[model samples]
Target chain A: MRMSKIVRFSADVLFGAILIFGFYIILHGHLTPGGGFQGGAVVATGAALVIVAYSYEEVLHMIKKAGLMLQESAGLVMFAGVALIALGLGTTFFFNYLANSGLLFGMSVPFGPNPGELNTGGVLPLMNIAVGIEVWGGLAIVILYMLSGISKAEEA
Target chain B: MIETIIHVLVIAGLVVSAILVFHFRDLLAAALASALFSFLISLEFYILQAPDVAISQAAIGAGLTTAIFILAIRSTKRYEEDIP
Candidate 1:
């Protein structure tokens, strides 16, 4: 894949910028417009840009296939585990266990006079993080598989 | 009022990008445009107060998916040919 100098530099810069921006989104997801999954995908896009500019072989070497699969599965299991923990605590699935307990970092922190306030305790933020990881990892795996398959086909 | 205007602009950008994705003869360009569409949709999700969905869509739909499509198409050598 021969790319012009301008194209190569542009793609590299765009890819790097998106990756950084995605992390920013993930970290501040609870307080901002971006979250884990969105940011993670942005990170993956940066990886993809490298693949497009260079070669799939090089990209694969950088991001191993096995590691991606493990990360994806781990994310799914972690999410399910959290749901099960909620059930075990005598609540329905995905109940805000921490919120109901009035606990923050194991200390009794009360909600500010109102139950549904934005600052009130809840597991929604945690769920958001879990889902973000799951989506990012799963999508990365899917893309990696597709790219690897294409590369194999080319080799044959 | 400002929020509404921003929302409208984002939606307009999305629509324009979608149109470009379909109309462009270049597959790579179309894929890139589609990524832009995904980003806009993510922003829409943010507006709708569903950051989780927005994040998922942005990551999976725009980032990784676009790269996969581009690489797969590149390997196939069909991107160079015009679509009928």
Candidate 2:
């Protein structure tokens, strides 16, 4: 459907709000109920809004399918690579070795309110971020591919 | 509890929306409603403490997926024929 000015403006505003909100959820994931996946999905919703309010062609121009595919693949590779790194470090898969110490950026950040809480850890945060990026990119790409295919069919 | 009530309501909403999606004659409305249904389901997943699944659902199920479905339907001759 073609977007009118009012609809486009509304969608743009909503998309921006969701994008910011998603980042908030991702950054404070440890201290909140939200996390990487939730935040990433929220961001994807923002992209979806752009597509819906504008057009698939516009969205595709902004975020090409090839670039989105690369992003998604990179995110998956990062997650798998991290797991492999943990294995090489003599830990089980998905172990958070980096999170074991409280040092981030050479400064000691307290793990949490409690000294050794499970909630406070090494690789969990990083994993969450990776998962978020992966989900967002992967889903957006899937949507883009579907829309593009439909458009192609229409032309044919 | 309030959480329990919310969960029930969300599930009910999902079921109702799903039925509407299948039964509705208007393709766009049905798709939009289905998207809302998926969004509620995602919210339910969040309440259940599965952010990962919720994220995927919200992104894939509610977001791009629905738009793609609608666009596909639009490209078909169905919407055009119904406009007159």
Candidate 3:
């Protein structure tokens, strides 16, 4: 069942902020306490809030399961591809091949207590992003599936 | 110290909320109480200096889990059936 006007309005307002913060957590996973899993979970909560605020048909129009399934697959493939690339580079799997190599997200870190930059952590940021997207898709799919079941039962 | 007092208070509330969850005959109320329990535990995690665990718990434990429980209740019964 959809909520009242205030609830829907608040959900819409908070969705963007929550999504941005979730992305922040995912992007800065390497430099912050929150990583891919945490950020993705945060984003999923926001999705749930929005879903709950709207009718089932409205939700279905906004979010499709197939799209989310593809998102999940893409994230998993990206994670694996990043790991496998290390083998092609003649390094072990999950290698920090890009670290200190002056590429994107490869700025070398001096070992000390200091402010961290986004352009570091080699393959970590990519891996974080991959896992984040996968988790977001997986969790949101679960919520959608539940709502689907409810709608089905209601129809019967 | 202030920190110690805060920890005690949070834990106390956590225990109380847990008991309320068990005591509630209304499943919806129980689900909400569990969310409160989750929120308190997340606070405790933050107090214990584990923001990662805290964030995950707050999101999954409080948010997603509550949503799932509420949906389950909506599909079925809101009050627990007394088999006795």
Listed models, DockQ each: 0.59, 0.50, 0.82
lDDT per residue as tens, model 2, B1-84: 999899889999989998998777778888899899989988998899887687778766887678777667767744323335
TM-score of chain A of each: 0.73, 0.83, 0.97
lDDT at position A93, candidate 3: 93
Give the per-residue lDDT of model 3 (tens digit) for A8-113: 9999999999999999999999999999999999999999988877878999899999999999999999999999999999989999888898998989899998
lDDT of 2 at A117: 33
Question: What's the ranking of the predictions by DockQ, best on top?
Answer: 3, 1, 2
Clashes of each: 3, 1, 0
- Candidate 2 vs candidate 3: which has greater TM-score? 3
- Residue pairs with backbone atoms closer than 3 Å in model 1 (clashes): A37-A132, A38-B55, A41-B59
Q: Fnat of candidate 2, please?
A: 0.69
Candidate that scores best on DockQ: 3
Q: Model 3 chain B — which ten-residue stretch has the worst lDDT?
A: B70-79
TM-score-wise, the better of 1 and 3 is 3
lDDT of 3 by residue, B1-84 (tens): 999999999999999999999999999899999999999999999999999999999999999999888777877878888888
Lowest-lDDT window of 10 residues in candidate 2 chain A?
A103-112
Model 2 regions more than 4 Å off: A105-120, B1-16, B40-59, B77-84
Q: Give the alpha carbon lDDT tens digit for every residue of B15-82 in model 1.
A: 89989998877788888899899989989998988977876787678766777777767786545564
lDDT of 1 at B41: 95
